[model samples]
Target: MSNEQAWEAVVVSKSRAPLDGSNLYRRVTVRHDDGPEEKIRVAREAWKQIEVGDRVMKEAGQDPRRA
Candidate 1:
């Protein structure tokens, strides 16, 4: 596969789970080919910001924005 194809296949899995007797939490995994994966936990509010930022970035050709 080409570099771009490999890059596209880079696994970035996102999921969420509820905390016992508390609000739900989110987890994001960023993995590289044959390398260790990075996991992060974020609260709901922070997760919203992340989701919004991702959408805007994708729509704007992955450009950063001030909001």
Candidate 2:
């Protein structure tokens, strides 16, 4: 991650689904700064803090954070 760049994206959607039985998998679909829409798996708390239209930032090794 030496060449990591900080970039921002807009959250378009969020979802959660069962992972196995009791656990769940959460994800968010974002429109990137570079012009692509991508779905990224995120932690429960992070997912909770995010909403559609929120801007998120990604800086290499770090997980995307609400901006």
Candidate 3:
């Protein structure tokens, strides 16, 4: 995938769970502009940066961003 292309999506829901002992994993469900909803795993720090209803730019296998 091209790194320059970021898909636009809206944060729909978020959940957190323990991953690999002390590390925490955040899962977020996002609705994309093209009409599909996806569940993506993200860093806890990145998850903390977003909220439901927030619009973000999502790159494949990368953290979401607001722009």
Candidate 4:
């Protein structure tokens, strides 16, 4: 399948250095049709929040792949 057809997104919470030492950064990646995937990365304990948003959107019949 084409990238667009195989679209998927991931939200990640990962650690950084210095300012974040041992802390995690939350990130999300959403696929697009005519350009690079969209990515939003942030700090704080954001994994649950981000994932919940994703799930809500999905359950509401919104396809994250279509933008």
Candidate 5:
């Protein structure tokens, strides 16, 4: 079995925070139908491509053995 997992979620909110001198990072909060809300950090450009109420698929986790 693979250690990776994916979920379908709805975007709840979005925020931005300073990364370095002038760079910024975006944080997106999403809620799953069967789970609590989760916050994910994404690139500013990628973040701009999504909006609240949008449905998105999120994936995480990796098997070290595959590395």
Candidate 6:
């Protein structure tokens, strides 16, 4: 993968789970642009901004962004 290129994918599912018995961890499952399923961890705000069927993109070193 090229650092300058971004991977674009569609959201398949989203979830939130408990961490350390108190904190919440948010994640999204996506059908990747390259044809594999991957889970991406996201910030609370970003997770709220996405839903099933929403589009997202990921750069080499950053969190997924809503598209």
A best-first ranking of the candidates according to their TM-score comes to: 2, 6, 3, 5, 1, 4
The TM-score between candidate 1 and the true structure equals 0.40
C-alpha lDDT of candidate 3 relative to the true structure: 0.79
Candidate 1 residue 33 Cα shift, in angstroms, is 8.5
Name the lDDT of candidate 6.
Answer: 0.87
Better of 5 and 6 by lDDT: 6
Candidate 5: lDDT of 66? Answer: 8
What TM-score does model 4 achieve against the real structure?
A: 0.29
Which pairs clash in model 4? none
What is candidate 6's TM-score against the reference? 0.81
Clash tally for model 2: 0
Per-residue lDDT over 2-66 for candidate 5, one digit per residue giving the tens place of the 0 to 100 score: 23775677888989977676877778888877878877776656687888888767456721110
Candidate 3 Cα deviation (angstroms), residue 19:
5.6
Q: Please report the candidate that would top lDDT against the real structure.
A: 6
The lDDT, on a scale of 0 to 1, for candidate 2 is 0.86
RMSD in Å for model 5: 7.0
TM-score per model over all chains: 0.40, 0.82, 0.72, 0.29, 0.69, 0.81
Clashing pairs in 3: none
TM-score: model 3 vs. ground truth:
0.72
Comparing 3 with 5 on TM-score, the higher-scoring candidate is 3
**RMSD (Å) per prediction:** 9.9, 2.9, 3.0, 9.3, 7.0, 2.7
Instruction: Rank the candidate models, highest lDDT first.
Output: 6, 2, 3, 5, 1, 4
| Pairs with steric clashes in candidate 2 | none
Model 4 per-residue lDDT tens digits across residues 20-55: 677554555543334455554443444334552242
Over 1-67, each residue of candidate 1 has an lDDT whose tens digit, in order, gives 2212322112256678776658676765544345665555545664555542142111122322112
